[model samples]
Target: MTGDLILYTNPMSRGRIVRWMLEEAGASYETRVLDYGTTMKAPDYLKINPMGKVPAIVHKGVVVTETAAICAYLADVYAEAGLAPAIGDPLRGAYFRWLFYAAGPYEASFGDRAMGIEVPADKRAMVGYGCFADVMNTVEAAVSQGPYILGETFSAADVYLGSQIGFGLQFGMTEARPAFTAYWQRLAARPAYVRATALDDALMPKTA
Candidate 1:
């Protein structure tokens, strides 16, 4: 494993998710902490992510942004970590299914809700998630059969989607349904999760 992996992130942001992923992959990486408005939007960082976002990774001269994409990319690059199903594995389909589901519908639906924006019932067809309730119900079903998303196997899909589930429950964006709480409990207990979270927590700006 080369030490060429660089993670550009802010402690209080979605970067924590990638931190967890890197820890899970047992990757050797350097963290470059960027403040939200200043360093994050500066030209040097903008070259890394034009949108000026947190949680971007540069590995061996290649840049990857977007939380889900970063997790997926790292999983493939570090195959020995076994964070992904093999390409021809039957479970591969379901892996991509729930991974993108969390990135898309699950995130979109909850983002809209957090901002107090509600799609009209008549316009539900135009909205990808249909409704917040539908998204929540579908997510509940996905995790209900778990010890992990792929039954007994844990993968990058769990790390990415599981982080979203964790954020939702933490911030009151998701209800404390029995299934959601239990699933997060299982994921949170991971040593990787604990290590990643402790690292970021220590970097968080201290309050006066």
Candidate 2:
């Protein structure tokens, strides 16, 4: 994709995650904030994403959807930013591993619990996340050995996974485990994370 990316987002949604990714990549982009039930569904926006989701991006006329995909895309295209592992690096496998796991089992497991959806014991094996406790335990151990997911090298994978943990803890989807808290503190201190949050906060609507 060429030219400045156009990010279609809502201030109070998962779009914040993508905004953080954009900032991390030092991407040149413009934000188009969509209202909850209106502009998001308008024909123009629908053309970009039929699901009417916030956090879609248009780069050189190519549309990118899904938060994880967009984050990875930016990391790759902006290779100089060093947000991703180099292609031939053996670490690339582990890099993609945690990134997808975060969006998959990590998110679905806790999110299922938050919405009061309980899986029967026998059915747990069939589920991707298995159980919330197991999922959290795995994540905690994953970060406990880290300065970053790649162990000393901060990359885009941390951005996605760390954001999930941060949001999950903030809204009760996950517990504030020491490992998770420490990981979030490291990520939250990044200038990009701070800038993205501030930019999004400025876009939020003021309440009376």
Candidate 3:
């Protein structure tokens, strides 16, 4: 908890999402952007994350990988940020609900669709996401109840789900349903989100 917090990332990758979470947490950290195909696959970086993935973090000498896990971990460790609900708070259950859902079902189904892979109906149960349409519909319903995932309050869950929703819109992977549109607008209004996005944009290639 006391050591230097180091983030190994590349702006073009999922590391950008963790960057948003870091900004939202208001925690001090340093970023080391690893170039893809070179630095990222280098031995030193791979030592931090065997999979050679971006968005890995080192805090107090401990390493954490995966975007969702990093988001949840940072929110809890920096409790004063209020990115997460307290342990006994009723919203805590709902908090975990959307967070894991985004990481699990949402991403799984989206990946399947993006890759043109089809899951047979009978085998759907074995796959957490079931199907792309089901995942999108579930998200549409959830955002419809919004302003945010927790209704009246915005938390780290928004950082995860909102970013995914935004990505979906940007790539035309999902339809811009009314609820998703409004929720994304609200998320974009946050100062932290704006600042984080600006930083990422600055790092993006001119052609990108």
Candidate 4:
């Protein structure tokens, strides 16, 4: 709970989501940017994340990989930031609900869609997300009643899920329903989100 926090990320990767969560958590951390296929696959980096993926974090000697896990870890450790509902808090159920929902169904469905991997109706039961329409509709409903995922308290769920929604919108993956558009707009206006985006954008690779 009291050690240096190190983030291994790339500006263009999902690491941006972890960066946003770090800013929201108000944690002091160092960042090491790993370029794809080089530093990312280097032996040293692989030790941190055997999968050799960006957006890993080392905190108090604990290594966390995967964007949602990293965000949740930061939120729990930095409880003072109030980025998660406390254990036993009624909202805690809903917090985990949407957080893992995004990490699992939303992520799976969106990735499949982007890759044009359709799940036939007969195979829908085997796939966790069921179908693209169901997944998107669920996402729409999740944000429709919200200024935040938990209705009011903005938690790390928003940081992870909002980043997914934001990315999906930017890349033309998600439908621009009014609810999603308005919800993303609200999250984009957060001070932490602004800072995180500016920092990452500054690190983007230059174009010729």
Best by lDDT: 1
lDDT by residue (tens digit), candidate 3, 104-155: 9999888989999999999999998888889988998888885889988788
Displacement of residue 19 (Cα, Å) in model 4 is: 0.5
Q: Pairing residues by index, what is the TM-score of model 2?
A: 0.96
TM-score of each: 0.98, 0.96, 0.95, 0.97
Clashes of 3: 0
Q: Which ten residues in a row have the lowest lDDT in candidate 3?
A: 1-10
Candidate 2's displacement at residue 170, Å, is: 1.3
lDDT of 2 by residue, 57-139 (tens): 88877799988898898899889999998989988998899999998998898778878888888999999999888888988
Q: Count steric clashes of candidate 2.
A: 0
lDDT of each: 0.94, 0.89, 0.89, 0.92
Number of backbone collisions per candidate: 0, 0, 0, 0
Report the C-alpha lDDT of model 1 over 44-94, residue by residue, as the tens digit.
Answer: 999999999899999999999999999999999999999999999999999
The deviation in Å at residue 69 for candidate 4 is 0.5
The root-mean-square deviation over C-alpha atoms between each candidate and the true structure, in angstroms, is: 1.0, 1.4, 1.8, 1.4
